[model samples]
Target: MTMPQMPDSPGTARPFSAELWTAIDPVYAAILDHPFITGLVDGTLPHDAFRHFVVQDSHYLRDYARALAVCAARAPGEDDVRAFAGDAAGAIAAEQEMHAEFMDRLGGSAAQAAAQPVGPTTRAYTSYLLATVYGGSFLDGLAAVLPCYWIYARVGEALLAKSSPDPLYRRWIETYGDEAFQGVVRRVVALADRTGAAATPEQRAAAVEHFVTTSRYEWMFWDAAWRRETWPV
Candidate 1:
C-alpha cells in the first residue's frame, strides 16, 4: 500500500512515527471494526475467547520482552537503552501479573495456561516479531514492536469512551487505557521518531514494511482469538 503523506511546511516534515500511523490507519480502522474488538466493546465476547487471548498473549509478551531487551542492547543512546530495558521489564511483569489474574478468573493458573499448546497464529506472530528484532536494526525492531504498544493504547482509549458493561471486559480496557500505559506508549513513539529521523531512505522504507507487517499481525491476533484458532494438522 502507498503511504499517505502528511502536509508539511518547507524544511519541516512530520515525524516518522506519524507516517507509520498514517500507513496503518486503514488497518487500524479495520481492527476497530473487527468482530473481536466490537465484541470487547459490547461485552459480547465469549469468556473462552478472552481466555485464549490472555493465554496466547502471555506467551507473546515473554518473547516480546526478549526482543525489547535486544533493542536495549542495540540502542545508541543511553536513555533509549534504559527506556527499552524498562519496557522489557514492564512486558515481563504484564505477562505475569495481568495474564495471571485473567487466567485465574478463567478457572486456570498461569502454569496450566502456559502448558497449553501455542495456537498457530500466536506462534506465527511471535516468530515474525522475534525474527525481525533479532536480525534487524534498532529502527526495525521498534517498528516491529510498536503496533503492540500503539494499537492497544488506541483501542483502549476508544473503548473507554463507551466502556464495556462486563466488569472483566472493563478491567481489560482500563488496563490499557490507564494513564501509565498511555505514557509508556508515548515514550516509545517518541523514541521511534528520534531513531527514525536519522535512518537512511532504505532503512526508513524497511521500517515502514516491518510496521505494516506487524500491524497486520496485530489484527490477525485478535481474529485468531475470536476464532479460537488451532493447528489444523
Candidate 2:
C-alpha cells in the first residue's frame, strides 16, 4: 500500500510531523552534505569505517527494537500498537539478516560483530531513545524514533539517484532505498501526525525538541562511523 505524504505549507497550519521535519530541515540538509553520506554515494568510504557502522548499527537496532516495543505498549489504539509491535519484530528479525549480510561482505561474522563494542555515539543515541520511550509520552517516543526512519529513507532516496559503483556500497544504499522501507517510514510519519494532532501544546513542544535532538543524532551516528568513534578512557 502507498503511504500518504504529510502536508506542509508556510501559509497553512501543518501537521505535527511536517512541523517536526521543517524544524530539522537544516539538520537534514547538512546530513545530505556530510562526508559520510557522500562517501556512500561515490564509494569512497573506507572499508573499516563501513564495517564499524555495521557493527555499531547491529547494536543500535536491538535497542531501537526495544524502544519500539515500548511505543507499542504506550500506543492509544490497536492499529498503532500492532504497527509498532510488528516493526519491533521486523527490526530484530528481518533487518538483522541485512546487517549480517553486510557484516559478511565486510569480512566479519554476526558473532564477531556481536562481540564488538558499541561505539560511543551508538551508545549515546540508543540511550536517548530508550530514555525517551520509557520516560515520556507516546508522542515523545514517536518523535524520538522518527529520524531513524525518515532520515534514512530520505538519504537512501537521495543516494539512489547516483548510486555507488561498488557492489557492497550499492547494496547498502539499496536496502534503505527500497520502496518497502520507505512505506514503513511513511507509516511511522503518519502515526506521528495523528498522535501529534491530539497532543497538548507542551507535548507538541516536547516532540519538536525530541525530533531535533534525534535528528542531530542521526548525523552524529554517520559521523561517528566516519571517524570510527571510540571510548577515550
Candidate 3:
C-alpha cells in the first residue's frame, strides 16, 4: 500500500505515524468489527468475558514489560531507550493498579490471580513478541509491539466516543482513550516512523510482516476474551 503524505511539521516534509496507520487500516477495520469491542461499547458484553480479559491482561503485561526492556536496550538512541523503559514501567504499574481495581469489582483475589494459568491466546501473543524481540531487528520488534500501544489508543478513543453506559466498560474505554495515553502512542509512532524511513526495502518488509502478525494477534486477543478461552489441560 502506498502511504499517503501527512501534513508536514514547521520545517520538515516527512510523513509521520499517519502513513503507517493508513497502511494498517484494513486490519484495524477488522479489529473494530470484532464482537468483543462492539459488545463492550454497547454494554451487552457478558461480565464474565470482561473479567476474563482483565485477568489475562494482567498476566500478559508482566511479560510485555520484559519485551519492552529488550527493545529499550536495542534502541538506537538514549531517548528511545528511556521512552521504552518508561513504557515498560508504566505497563507494570497499570497491570497492578487497574487490574487490582477490576478484581475488587469483578470478584477475584490476588491468590486466584497469581495462580491463574496463561490462556492459550495470551501465551501465543506474548511468546510471539518475546521471540521477535529476541531474534529480530530493533525495528522489527518495535513494529511488532506497536499495535499494543497504537491499537489500544485508537480503540479506546473510538469506544469512548460511543460513551458506554456500563461503568466497567466505560472505565476501560476511558483509560485507553485518555489524551495522555495517545501522547505516548504518538511518541512511539514517531520513533517507529523515523526508523522505518531509514530501513532497507527487505528490512522494511520484515518489519511490516511483524507488524501485521501482531496486529492480527490483537484481534485474536479480544475474540479470545469474548470466548473465555482457556488452555487444554
TM-score of each: 0.95, 0.94, 0.92
- Candidate 3: the clashing residue pairs are none
lDDT of 3 by residue, 1-233 (tens): 11223677798745535555666889889999988899888999899999889889988899899999999999999999999999999999998888888888889865577578889999999999999999999998998889999899888887777978799889999999888998898889889889988988788778888888988899999889999998768
Give the per-residue lDDT of model 1 (tens digit) for 1-233. Answer: 11233576689867998889989989999999998899988989999999999989998898889988998999888998999999999999998898899898889999998898898988898899899999999899899999999999988888888899888899999998888888888888888889899999899999999999999999999999999998999
lDDT of each: 0.89, 0.89, 0.86
Expressed as tens digits, the lDDT of each residue in 47-100 for candidate 2 is 898998888889999999999999999998999899999999988984469888
TM-score for candidate 2, please give it: 0.94
| Clash count (model 1, backbone only) | 0
Instruction: lDDT winner between 1 and 2, please give it.
Output: 1
Spell out the clash pairs found in candidate 1.
none
Query: Least lDDT summed over 10 consecutive residues: which range in candidate 3?
Result: 1-10
The alpha-carbon lDDT assigned to residue 144 of candidate 2 equals 96
